[model samples]
Target: MTLKSVFVLTTLSLAAGCHGHDHGKSEGGKEGDHGHPHGAAAAELPGQSVTIWAQRTELFMEYSPLIVGQETGFAAHLTELPSFKAVTAGMASVTLKYVDGTTIVATADAPSNPGIFRPKLLPQKVGACELLVDVKSPQVTETFSAGPCQVFASADAARKALGEEAEAPGRITYLKEQQWKTDFSLAVAEQRDLQNGVRASGEIRPVAGKEARMTAPVAGRVELASPAPLLGTFVKQGTVLASIAPRPSAASDSATLAADVAARQAEAAAARAELGRAERLVAAQAAPSKLVDEARARLQVAEAHLDGASGRLAQYNANSSGGAAGRRFQLRSPVAGTLVAIHAVTGENIEEGALLFEVIGLERVWLVAQVFEPDLPRVQGARAAWFTIEGYEQPFVVDEKTSKLVTIGHVINPRTRTAPVIFELDNKEGRLRIGNFTKVSIATGAPKSALAIPEAALVEDAGKAVAFVMVEGEAFERRPLRLGVRSNGWVEVLEGVERGERVVTKGAYEIRLASASGAVPAHGHVH
Candidate 1:
């Protein structure tokens, strides 16, 4: 499997079970205003006559053109007032009737854009007021009532009123109604191969099979008869390491020689007597059978003694002739491996069964892994797996012969709370080390395709999981979604989005802030 990046950082995907919040105003704001649930600045103005013009839209005019002049006493009053183009480019004259028996008349250039209108004067009555707008255009003429007007004498006062209005019922820009967005990304999962299934801290380990020391069976002065291998040397099975020569002291030398000679002479005499006895018995029809049998038995015993004497004498001669004064014993390697340690010096005497040397087999190595309780189930039946060594960063797969879990420690390790799970790894390629630590990953379950995205792409809004969907140019909308199984770096999107839609995969927070601030443009297609 391919990982796109190793150090990639992405946002965490909120689980489908979570929730998100919206901070926008409710949908009840009046027409032609930032009806966001959050409070916004109010419409500024002067109270006067409102009149509709003949043209539908006039560019850079004093009043909206789509509206016709309602011929009233106030409309006549506004015609005589100082006229200047309104802030909007295309507005014409329009007249409105306040419910309080007063009229406000105004003229603008055109109606290319729609916005709230405030005459440069306030109505006589206080509190809220509704006025009727008589709009006329080349195509059609329409009349509509404009609300519960919040009128103030100055811009600052209007702004304050707007704030209060925002908090009041039926106001737009409610904070609870807004939605925020975020982006997400994905990367490959890192892999490691632990051979000694998760090792726990402080687990007792016996020296490997060959690390134990083996000593000479008998005590003697040691010497190498040939070019014997020493400490740090490698030996094959049955290769002799050294030879030991047993020496004779001044007191024991003469006695050993005399006993040897006597044993030889006795053996010879006994053999001759036995041969004569057997021949005579056969000829005389039975010198008693018992006597002949006894003589033969004695002869056999004598011959064995003689053979032992000869072998010992030969050993002594070989040692004395070699500038050494003792019978030598050969110390051979019991197993094939490298000699790691030695306690014996060339001239030092060693006791029987004393440790002399240590050997190790390096052909195979162990990779130990510390299996955490949660991870144990996943690796239970894993036959083949791989891991990466820390220094090498190279991954090695467990060989089939050593892939099986050799052991699972019974007692939980108190320190690490991990159990030992061991597997053998091949070192023939020289790629693995006996004690190197590695990170491992096992394919615990079968792979299946699911709708997935980077976790970062999700954000919480009003306790719901949401992502930003890029709708029109530079415009994104918050979308609620449900999530499913996640693996590697990708989270499964179970709902609220479809494949191929460019959900914000990055810079989602900034986009959300802009939307809440009204920096985002509303689509002309919005209902």
Candidate 2:
């Protein structure tokens, strides 16, 4: 079996119990949905049917009464478990594993239809033992048990032993064939403790202290750096985005300031010379010490004048140069973020207070919602809140670990009668965009415990919300839902469904179509 599975699975053969999902486009009815029932292959039988579940396969067989030296036909409906799809191709063998170690095996090469396999067993001896259906294919090899079955001694004895079919009314008969071919799934209903909350309209925003506005510190012509920091560009703190060439003025002209610095330097040199001469004369007893002191003070004043002129020249020259300088101010990003806006352009001369650029950190964003004034009290005490955006069914949770409440406005809008409520959200996935409209829910009250299911499970039929609850392996019943609170992709069920009961979650539309047509496909195999 291992060697066979290795060769079959390695070849990736779809010829076994496995099949390609795409058969062809459907003609548009239940007949087209799961494939039309294999009516021609089915023939009526007298005895009861047995359905059993194995690790990987489900076998539902309808077989005739067993008797010695008599041939018994078994119509095996093989379905793959978990997926609930048909085992389209496989070799099915029905074997009677007797207590005394004797066995009778019947073999069918392939399914009469996709999920139907017919096998015949000739019991040479009568016994009470396990009925095992073994399916072998490149895709799967599984043996399903129908538990203990009987092989009668004679036909009259068989009639008395297998009495009569039980009364089966109002039991919706969905064949395993239909379930295997259609989109199908089941979800267990369970008790959930959900927080009660109120809904409000909201918008995504950049969090406070995460956004930085860059402006010109002095009146200058804008000069952009290499790879101009365009809108939507990510930048780091102190990354030079552009430079500003200060508009020259008469007082701060580079040439005039340079000349003033030279004159001041000359004055300082002459003062130093005079101070040296005064000190020499004082040492020779030709002048007073006060004259030397006065010379030293004059040199200090001249040097101070030189430094003042030099400072002005550097300031006007953009701090780079006095000899050849105009680019004085280097505009840099104040924070690490995406460059969201650019107000100034290259070579544009602007005032000192003119706006230049805007950068905003998008790693974390704020969800701002407006609550009705009457609902403001509840929002103010909210411990948790979440918001849903387009393209996402579940709301993003705003918790203390990744996010927190930023503020709840006390002031109410006079015209709209709403107050602003804000929550900081983790936008690490980059799903939340600023200015995006959203639906928000804030949990203000205590948690309410009740049975619930996924919001996707409910289907509207004839203006009533209904769910298909599984009754058996191949049966389902519709139950109208009595709804209560809904939050976080789940809806609270007040009535109509019990906890632990399974309901159709996926491929529910097929069930709806089946129910509406009132067609239970023929048991598509012979006994």
Q: Candidate 2 overall Cα lDDT vs. reference?
A: 0.72
- Badly placed stretches (over 4 Å) of model 2 are 1-42, 46-185, 213-234, 242-329, 339-358, 472-474, 519-527
Clashing pairs in 2: 318-328
lDDT of 1 by residue, 139-161 (tens): 33334333234334543553343
What candidate 1 gets wrong by more than 4 Å, as runs, is 1-212, 228-233, 246-325, 351-353, 370-378, 399-403, 410-418, 437-443, 447-527
| lDDT string, candidate 2, 281-381, tens digits | 99999999999999999999999999998887766554343244533567778789989889978889988778999999999888899999888877765
Worst ten in a row by lDDT for model 2: 5-14
Steric collisions counted per model? 100, 1
